[model samples]
Target: MKLSISRYNPELDSRPYMQDYEIALVPGDHMLLDVMLRLKQQDSTLSFRKSCREGVCGSDAMSINGRNGLACITPVRTLHGTVVLRPLPSFPIIRDLVVDMTNFFQQYHSIKPWLENPEPPPEKERLQSPAERERLNGAYECILCGCCSSQCPSYWWNPDKFVGPAGLLQAYRFIVDSRDKATDERLENLRGPYRLFRCRTIMNCAEVCPKGLEPSHAIEKTRMRMLHVEASGELDTHTPPAGRPSITN
Candidate 1:
């Protein structure tokens, strides 16, 4: 099998290029990541990220045959011809097939993905009823692999302002958690034009998610919550202070 992988080194090359490698496919070899590992064995300088070899880690996400997905889960045999591999689009390339994820994580952090509750802790851990827990099923499964967000046109245009599908999915995750005490505050922080409204419902996020999670659905739920807040006359009170950073589209 032949793999044409994108190669880039900011220190050495001004732009990215492709390099081809031929690997002898064995009976047990199936996944694209396995093929990459075989290629790396021949050229030790080839760089990429992988962890857990399973798709759970989401670290091996890249453009495979012009689609965004986790290489760890993609079967190499499913690809008909020469395979083309590239880093996740719209991110700073660190090296061959490795994109810098600093901005991706920053957007995640901006949403405060953790549960926020200022109330005193209970004797036991905070627990949710089964029905409440079910609300998080789709939203909580996100592995934070760059696939969905990298494929999003809105995020590509407003990378700095829009939190993107992964962040918004997590935002919905916390927003719907019955135990979280900061639902209102979370909604307040995301009230800006780009923060929550930039999602055009293009469905690219849901289409490329390796986990089959529907980030667009979660985004819609968040939008409904914002509308509910507005209709209830609750939006005026939580206006951010003057000179506060505004995330606009």
Candidate 2:
């Protein structure tokens, strides 16, 4: 199989370039990371980032054949036509296939993902019924893959203003949890322009998600929940300042 890869070295290079690699790939032996390793063996100058060969670590995501994908998870046998590898779009490229994740994590942390209880804890861990746990199911499965956030148009503009997919899912995880009692405060924090308006609902995040997770849906639920909170006449939040439109059905 043949794969075209992007190569760059910031300390020694002015611009990036493409290098084609023709590797021997058996039906089951072809993995994206394997192909990259082969290319590096032939030319040490070739560079890419990879961490767990499995998909969980989310370290090897790149544009595979023009689609955002995890190199570790992409099987060589699944590819059609010439494979084109590029850096994830709309990010500052660090080198070859790696991009700066500082902004991504920054947005993630702004949402205050960890459990925050104004109320004191019980004598032991809080317990809930199975039905209650299911409410936050969609958000709890996220592995912070960055595919959703990177593909998000909101993150492309002011990543700081918008809590991207990872953050939104984390927010959803707690928002729906029956044991958590701070939904209103969290909604209040997210009601402001930077929190709600940033998501453009382009669905790019949902499209590229490796786990088939719908981070957009989580964002939509947050929007609706916030609206309901406002409509109850509690926060006295004003009408959504212009330019913010509800994109969910």
Best by lDDT: 1
Best by TM-score: 1
Q: Which residue pairs in candidate 1 collide?
A: none
Each candidate structure's TM-score, on Cα atoms with residue i matched to residue i, is 0.93, 0.91
Worst lDDT 10-window in candidate 1: 240-249
**Clash count per candidate:** 0, 0
Give a tens-digit lDDT track for model 2, residues 1-249. 777888777997798888787877655566878877877888787767788888888888888887788988888779877789988877678988888888787767777777777687889988889999879777877777677877777777877688877788788888888887788888887876767667777888889988788888888888888888788987777768567776557
Residues 1-249 of candidate 1 have per-residue lDDT tens digits of: 988999998899999999988889987688988888888899999999999988899899999988999999998769878899999999889999889889889999999999889889999999888999998899888899989999999899999999999999999999999989898899988887788788888889999999999988888888778777877987774543344332222
Question: What is the lDDT, from 0 to 100, of the residue 228 in candidate 2?
Answer: 81
Q: TM-score for candidate 2, please give it.
A: 0.91
